[model samples]
Target: MPAALADGVVTRIPTSRKVVALTFDGGAGSQGAASILSTLRSQGVPASFFVTGEFATANPALVRQMAAVGPVGNHTWDHPHLTSLSDTAVRTELSRAESAVRAATGRTPRPFFRFPFGEYSTRTLALVHASGYGAVGWTTDSLGWKGTSGGQSVDSVVARVLAGRTPGQVVLMHVGANPDDGTTLDAAALPRVIAGYRAAGYGFTTLDALR
Candidate 1:
């Protein structure tokens, strides 16, 4: 793991195959979760989710459903910026999230984590590794979390995902809606995005490639 962590953070799946890893981050809310799950199941697509401790604790049923389909990674306890916390605090966040996931679904979120707001520093990276987790970033963000109010629509989300298409690409999306506009663009764009990818002759994958 240290040899892999030597690179600091992973933004793309470490492969040259024509497959992309779809990932969702959950923190503030679970507005789009059910729809996202339904779309993935209906399309037979696989995706990973990185959720906070608070989210798992609050939404145990959703966590179970997520764990049933794909791997769930830790996104920290409160989704705090790891770079802003001390070493012990950072560790506590990771451990707390891991515990919350286990408590909710009786499954472990070992060795996989993502920084809140994609924020981290060299020291924070080392701290994450030391806490027994790998930091997974993304090849591109769908930006659907920004919602229509932020000038993002379902079409833009699909476009951003297709624009980042490549071998082992990691697409980042959020399971929550925009706090301001309350739009779940990711869920709305998911079916179309999956169709577009299949039409482009690309396959879907989870972050398990890195494991």
Candidate 2:
């Protein structure tokens, strides 16, 4: 049975295929955005990008590129931890981000939502569910945001995802939102990650498929 959250949203997968989803979050940088998109395009891999409203507005071209290849989900306006915000604030964040993505891509994304930093309360989940968005959390984390030597290593990240991830897994990564962080490492690791997964007989899917 699928795991149902507040407001009747289901989180678990309904299928049994040996496929997982790759999702990038918070894309607004020029070089980092271009590099990641190009890598995915070159590899013929599709990924979901959970973008903040502000970032989408600032980098509309990047948003269009992401949407052109795969699905673009809402990641809030400023990447705030939705757990700490009121319901009204949560709505604003999601609505603004959805609007920006639609304006940039001219396509409305499916009802998918990834909470920034994976911080969400029951109330936040309820709000998201009521708003018709499925709350997406990862099954395997690359820890690419940590900036540790291990986290910055592409081989290490790919190995972790390939070894631990199973069907319907959502592999979490970032697209250079934090200036002081190691999102560059994520960009570097992407090609290896895709190759590793493909070699392991796993096909990538967007978050909409999971829903």
Candidate 3:
């Protein structure tokens, strides 16, 4: 199940489109952030960004730039695993990130949150619901965090996303400073990923649309 619908969480939109939402987590590194936004704009693609509060504050300009391009969601203060934190801690994380996003973008984020590692509990889910945000997870992950030298092979990443994708799929990638793990494949593979999806007749949307 996509993160939006996991644990039977529901959205206001009816799930009836051959559309998928592409989401990038963390990172607002100067050059990398510019490149990602440039690529998306040039390709006419829109994405959802789940940004950490620290990242948003560090790169307020980039956050505004991204928000101008598409929807931005809270990815928590430091990208901690919400399920491991107590309920009060989890709420604090969500609240702090939400505050940062609102301060940077001048608009409150939509009801969208992605767990740091897709790890959550019933209590976390309920808190997310109570916070009025939909919990989002990915159906197809590009695994771009693993910064393999050959990992960015456009053909392979495209193949993976296209091979397993279904309507309403949520695709996950990253925009943070390259992970020590070989997952930076996302940045290198991004262009091809977008092209392949377009070729496959899949329209891209933000998580707000997914919801």
Candidate 4:
């Protein structure tokens, strides 16, 4: 059954080797998306993006560009916390995102779904898989969501990412800006982060490559 396949919602892939997946979420403050994409492209690195429906619809051109270079996944309709919604609502959210992603990329997104705000429950998990997506979680959060506000600077964001990184770790970042001052550090910090990882001998891979 799909539930069995989606068991426990993958937080990190089980691997002993020195590999990590770099992933970004696209939602509200996606104006910095192009820069993030540019950094990824310039590095020739593979990554994954979990974008909301509004993000895909509002930025179709950016969506297509990301799809060409990295795999895309459903991040829900409007970045709602699934645990707050009924099972039916959860399904609706995921389906709407799927539809948007498909429209933008002309392909069904990878069957990877991430709960908005990293919030989920058993019922939400079952609903996610029932909607045909494997719920994805993170082992390492870039806290890039912190951006330059929330008392965290660009250097702090990079430090947070470097500190939590480990083999088989899945890092979480955002293509959006901070909700506070609308500061966007992800694009600026990504190139340095990538370079740091390479220096540390950590290889990058996409989520699809994880499984």
Candidate 5:
């Protein structure tokens, strides 16, 4: 992410296998939630969702389903930029998100967190760690949230994914849509992407497993 992490923010796993972790960010409502979940379930791929407190509270069914399958990570209370908040404010945000996920899924969120906007300061990192989570960063982002995840084109998303993929990498994709465009690229492209990875002899794993 920033060249190096003086604190313990993990961008990729330290391994040399063809194993990749696909993580989804669901900080808002359930826009493409069904498609993403169905594809992941039908394809038997594992993922970790970093859901905000607002998201979990708004979509309890989706949150429960996610928790039933794999790990969920805290994404803060309302997708606030943690760098702008005080240390107490940051802890409160994380705590609220953790509590929300726990309330929805009957399990505490995994001790992992993702900062809103991928913006974090040294103080933010220290605060998250103190709150009992290893900050989750990404090696390559799918950019699916920008415009249908990339540019209102499924092919573009796949192309970007194939071009940037590497062993032991953490791929970031989102499960919501842009309000203006109503585009969600990753779901439609997921099966093809999965097929592509399988064809190339790559295997899938969850971030929790990777860590």
Candidate 6:
């Protein structure tokens, strides 16, 4: 299959197989990391993780644990909007994040990266590629990071993900809590989402497949 690239970023896995890629972004507090990991393990599912340099540095053990199970991608140094920074700054962000993840897991986060906040530009894309990484974007955003106060619930999160069900679908979730409410809606809704997808006859995959 030809890899799907939208503006030089992978928005889906680009396969004809009935599979979905589950991915989590780690930029802040990892209130949901443990639950997400446990659920994935219990279900024997493969998922991807994108972590900021700060997050990786602060949660080395958890990062290593994630790396043990699935591929870990870079999410930049301070979760900055790459388009807002110069080429040099963008490269630095990628380098710093890569260094942090390597230090934590003894593995390079090469060939896989996700834009912080999903923000990027044409120039930024070239910068990312030159830095030896491919940017990944989601086909379906769970929106669980919005929390209850933001009018998102566990059930809603499940529904949203299932609503976008498709072959090679990439589902976006966050491993951190909603800053305003401290709710981990994605983690809370994960088991049901997995079950729902299984019932719908979809298998799980990780970004590593892109390699």
Q: Using lDDT, give the best candidate's number.
A: 6
Candidate 1 lDDT over residue span 1-211, tens digit each: 6345346789988777889999999999999999999998888898999999999999999988898778899999998877878899998999999999999889888778999999999898888888788899999999999999999999999999999899999999999999999999999999999988899999988877787
Write candidate 3's Cα lDDT for 139-173 as tens digits: 88775555455354545766777776677777887
| TM-scores, each model vs. reference | 0.97, 0.87, 0.86, 0.94, 0.93, 0.96
What TM-score would candidate 6 get against the native?
0.96
lDDT-based ranking, best first?
Answer: 6, 1, 4, 5, 2, 3
Question: What are the per-model C-alpha RMSD values against the true structure?
Answer: 1.2, 2.9, 3.5, 1.8, 3.1, 1.8
Model 2 score (lDDT) = 0.76
Which residue runs of candidate 4 sit more than 4 Å off their true CA positions? 1-5
lDDT of 5 by residue, 1-211 (tens): 1223335778887668898888888986578889999998988988888999999999989998887657898999999988999999999999999999999999877577888998998898988877878788898887777774335588888888877778878888888887768888877778888888888889887766644
Candidate 4, 9-100: lDDT as tens digits: 78776777788888889989786788988888888988899999999999999999989887899999899877888878887888899999
User: Residue-wise lDDT of candidate 6 within 76-154, one digit each (tens)?
Assistant: 9999878889888998999999999999999998878899888888899988887778889999999999999999999
Residue 110, candidate 2: C-alpha displacement in angstroms = 3.7
Error of 6 at 6 (Å): 10
Q: What TM-score does model 1 achieve against the real structure? A: 0.97
Which residue pairs does candidate 1 place in steric collision? none
lDDT of 2 by residue, 60-92 (tens): 888999998888988888887778788898999
Clashes of each: 0, 0, 10, 0, 3, 0
Residue 7 local lDDT, model 4: 83
Poorest stretch of ten by lDDT in candidate 6 = 1-10
Q: Between prediction 4 and prediction 6, which has the larger TM-score? A: 6
lDDT, candidate 4, residue 104? 98
Q: In candidate 4, how many Å is residue 195 off?
A: 0.7
